[model samples]
Target: MADFKLTYATMFNPPEELHAGFDKAVEKLKKNMGQEYTMLIDGKEVKADEKFDDHSPVNTDWVLAKMQKGNSKHAQDALTAARKAFPMWSHTPWQKRVELLRKAASLIEERIFDLGAAMALEVGKNRMESLGDVQETADLIYYSCYQMEKNDGYIVEMGKDPLVGYDARNVSVLRPYGVWLVVSPFNFPFALTGGPAGAALVAGNTLVIKPATDTAWIVRLLVDCFRDAGIPDGVVNFVTGPGSTLGQALVDSSEVDGVTFTGSFDVGMKMFQDFGKRNYVRPIILELGGKNPVVVSKNADLERATIGIIRSAFGLQGQKCSAASRVLVEDSVYDDLVGRLKETASKLVIGDPTDRNTYNGPVVNKSSYNDFKDFCEEINQGGGKFLVGGNVKTGGMFDKGYYCESTFVVDLPFSHRLWKHEMFLPITTIGRVKNMDEAMSIANDVNYGLTAGFYGSPEETEWFFDKIEAGVTYANRPQGATTGAWPGFQPFGGWKGSGSSGKNAGGHYYLPLYMHEQIRTLVK
Candidate 1:
């Protein structure tokens, strides 16, 4: 177990010890269910006037935790606390900041299994995916710390100004923005929340984290790691509630210096527009959802292509932003690849995610379950055929939760809007292309350029790389066609409408997004 490392790409073949630890942790966590949680502000347990029950997607009758229903006032209180702590946190030495953040990362790793169990129950991700999310969050924080140390705190000595009469010196320094807010999505809740939060804190910014309503329990546990790591009082705060009151309040506030939001395209775009209305333009980093695509060439390995497509299209119930929602196959092998994809998808077990045999689980909530039905109806109305699944599961345990079958649609015309929409469900649309050129044309036609996958010969792989418009691209890998991004290995982000900043997170350039540069000069 010591020699083995875990990543989304490598999670398929983990050590047996890993499974044993996860099972033990799940048993322990089950005994502590139905506990009440509170929001964290100024390092104190703050309770709201109203509260909401967080239910497990695996079974709706199970109340995982009772969470606070934060309002606009609570949002303002969190911002004020973070704003007040900014001076002390920003002034702390960079090395000290790194030390504390690293401690927090270590805490996350130490509690990986416990957090993983919470995530599986809350987000409806299978055991491996849930564990991978927890481990990835720790790695992301460690990566940011490594980046901070590698760059020597982002303070660089520059060349002296050319002046014969006087001695001159110049230096460049990157500094943090104040009161940064992180609004994370339900999918990969741990990584998305803690990744940005770690970057923000390690860069010397104070934080206020707001997680998705459906998955606040896991984020609260993550916040506990930071707080337990001895981050100064008020340096990091957590708030949970509906997006309309609490989330919008945090976004609309002029006090927030910057923000990192991960969610839908329309909501992100709306926030971008609202930020523009401020007195001065402020930094807003966004990772909107993606309608990712995968292209299969005629000469590609049909077996490898089918395996990769099925994994990427159906993993996490296909709710990932990088899910392969569109698969364009060359006309010669379209039928062959589609048959294999349907066969592989049909074998994925849909039940409680905590179970060892379960590969797929229920959708995150009732809203998503209803959306899946609506989207399937829309596809059928537009002359699309379901190659695999198109109905909701019922009877027994399925009726106890928000269970929906993994769906693959075919014969959907290119003219149909579903071809380009981001369904964010276990629903993928397949299309046939006459040639590689036609496939590339259709792949790059969408507004999203987040992640893409290709399977073909060496020369064709190079051509696919040259032609694809996505930020993250993979070629001929059975692991995942468009999914599985690690921190140092594959820095994940998007382009065009998929992301606000061009720089990908967990990469070389991501840590700097939380900072602004200043040049200092002295003459004698």
Candidate 2:
């Protein structure tokens, strides 16, 4: 019945309605209810003095009551809890743990809508987009179950080495670190969190999720969903705070055996540095900032390419770590491509996110919009012509929520800093490259190498594929038109500045982060 503002400055409070079916079920199962939002430490709730508001970015719709703003004290609490729980969790029978993960996945499937609503309100995504996030998260949950169960070492087998008569060993067994600190970003909060937590839980690691302060309600909802699946307390916990304090706690905590982060490069690198301060470096998997580039080949399809480029770069208001900020087109097709891009970009309705028809919603807040706007100005000052959109205003009828023109610009070099740094908003820079080599040269020039796409013939695709340097590369496509980050395969993390290790999210390789592998030998 009540509405709230969605921005960074607001405070999040848990309200009564949060318990509709979500809370009642927890109580029916005799789950503890109405505990002060606290650090989940050693499988228990410990209170915190600080709290922040979880808001709706779409409008000034103030949703949830105060979200717990975590501090070093809270981080210590969760780390302690994870430490105590880790020994048992790490050694927990992997098969049994796998079943628990399946339960978690099922719980998500049943309560998708409840979580979806929280996502829609908190993060400013529309109904369907929120659902997509939830579904992506749930798919990851289900995959985590199989990932652990079907892992090489989960089932025993025999093998022989060339020098040894009979050498037999399972590939590797998964073990939980005593503690893991998870820092999740605002975009795709559910899917992002679910990927790691599902694997960690299956591998018997306890998780302390520091979800984005903006979407704490979704985090709260996710915690309850896991609880519904009979996950024990402290196995999965919540902490809402600025990344600085909490992230430092994890990096410095002796008990925190590992950490997984999905956010900007600067923050991820800071954590990596902190992790290095100790002798035994905790595992740190960072899915960081991306300056993804889309290369439109001379022979590519413009109409489809336009739609794909818009969706790829601007979807989710261009707030994703993998958002395509740079658009490199072959000069032969550059004019037509830029014109079509501007035409389609102009049609995107940037306004109140609640309206389903609104394609591009506001950025997370004014700071993001201002940064994007300033970036556009800087580009314009550099002599780039604004083909369409790109004008932004603050402090008017719409003051708090952030929104940018579905901006399109041309004449900027592909190597411009505007394309180099990640701008968590919907702005595209269309650059013209003279030939295939020029396109490849410009595309691979950025420091951050997350994902890139090439639209051309099979030979040109092969040529670019061989030359372009990136973690995730696509061919004959406009960039982000496909689903699940990759076709059939979910979005993989990138390398260079893009990702810490460049491991794909949904593939079988994700388990190695939480679980350390060792091969033992018996000789006679």
Candidate 3:
């Protein structure tokens, strides 16, 4: 609260003091596992007849929590509650909303370790990624709050009209949509949910958040932070269940003023098309999955490119929408780059997420694990060669969890479906191109235009930046090639089929998406 700065998680140099705290928090959370988590509807806890268990991706036997399986009825209840609270909440002073958001962020920071632990178990992200996700959530809230203050509460005064007998004062005020529904994905549950929810709330809209089935536990933890920050109960609602039932009901509900979703492309497109069928036009903010690529030129630093591609491709087991799933290497240096990438990837540590030294964790669930295996098998059978890793590691840490080695494939045709489609697993395909032009062609050929990375000379970097079709791009970044976007620093979003609205989160256009412009003219 002193000076108001939101810093990223320092995984490499975490504070020694916080180390003990995180360890204690994880243990405490583990003991509380398997407890039933109810839906927060209209400031009251409601239980459903059916329930589902949240299990750790690292070990299915480990039940993180038991959550109520929300249905269409519960979704309607949430919408009704949000609509009932909308008038008072929408009229609440912008300064007051900002105050509450800041308080929420601070409270999240206070319980960062506990939230991190929940994320680790729920999403199978390593300690660093887990901690970073929670911290980023808090920062996302802060960034939205900052945007509100910087824009003067989104209330603009227009020029006055002069006439003989007419004195006209005109002003434009950005007003909130009635009620919003935030649909979050499994990966980055806290950040994705909190970021959009924070923007909607700060813009004076009440929300009903439905997290992915795999991440309900972590979502519950985040909702607690908002409740503790003095957000009125009905102002923010939380529900958990399958996307087919609960999510569809929320999206199809006529009561929802606007919607924000982050998930697969098919579902997002369906939601977009469905929202259009309403009687009136409504805004839909979407961040769909990406088949992102990275181009490594002949002039690139092979070591830097190797490290960047490996980290970006395998981070979070490549579950991220912005993960680099394709690599195009210049013909002159393609072999060298591929060899180094294979060597480095084979050395990555894959194990339980709770271990501090683990770099690669299990996939989010068994379905993803099967996807990893099937993709590798199909690629191998299609005459592609495994550059380094292709086998799934089993019988130890991987016995109960969904674990697979980081896989790199080569000699596959560029036209193959595996190369064009998104796998959303710890798998990457490498191909050789004649030059930067060819590399750029391959990178832009995919349907997704989300995030991209490039390593090349200054002229090539400029050319890449100018020609790349992605919404987010980076050049010569060692932290990550096509991933590692931080809030405020990099407002993360997608383009083309990868996103619905062109606006990126944590940027200037985000909060405005939740608002509708009202022009006022007064004659005195």
In angstroms, the error of model 3 at 468 is 0.0
TM-score of each prediction: 0.99, 0.87, 0.97
Error of 3 at 149 (Å): 0.5
Cα lDDT of model 2 by residue, 357-389, tens digit: 666667776567678878887888877888877
Task: Say which candidate scores most in TM-score.
Answer: 1
| Quality of model 2 by C-alpha lDDT | 0.69
Question: Model 2: residues >4 Å from true position, as ranges?
Answer: 1-39, 42-45, 61-63, 152-172, 393-397, 478-488
How far residue 514's Cα lies from its native spot in candidate 2, in Å, is 1.8
The residue ranges of model 1 lying beyond 4 angstroms of the native Cα positions read none
Select the stronger candidate by lDDT from 2 and 3.
3
Segments of candidate 3 deviating more than 4 angstroms: 1-10
lDDT of 1 by residue, 396-438 (tens): 9999999899999999999999889999999999999999999
Q: After superposition on all CA atoms, what RMSD does each candidate show versus the true structure?
A: 0.8, 7.0, 1.8
Q: Can you list the residue pairs that collide in candidate 3?
A: none
Model 3: lDDT to the true structure: 0.89
Best by lDDT: 1
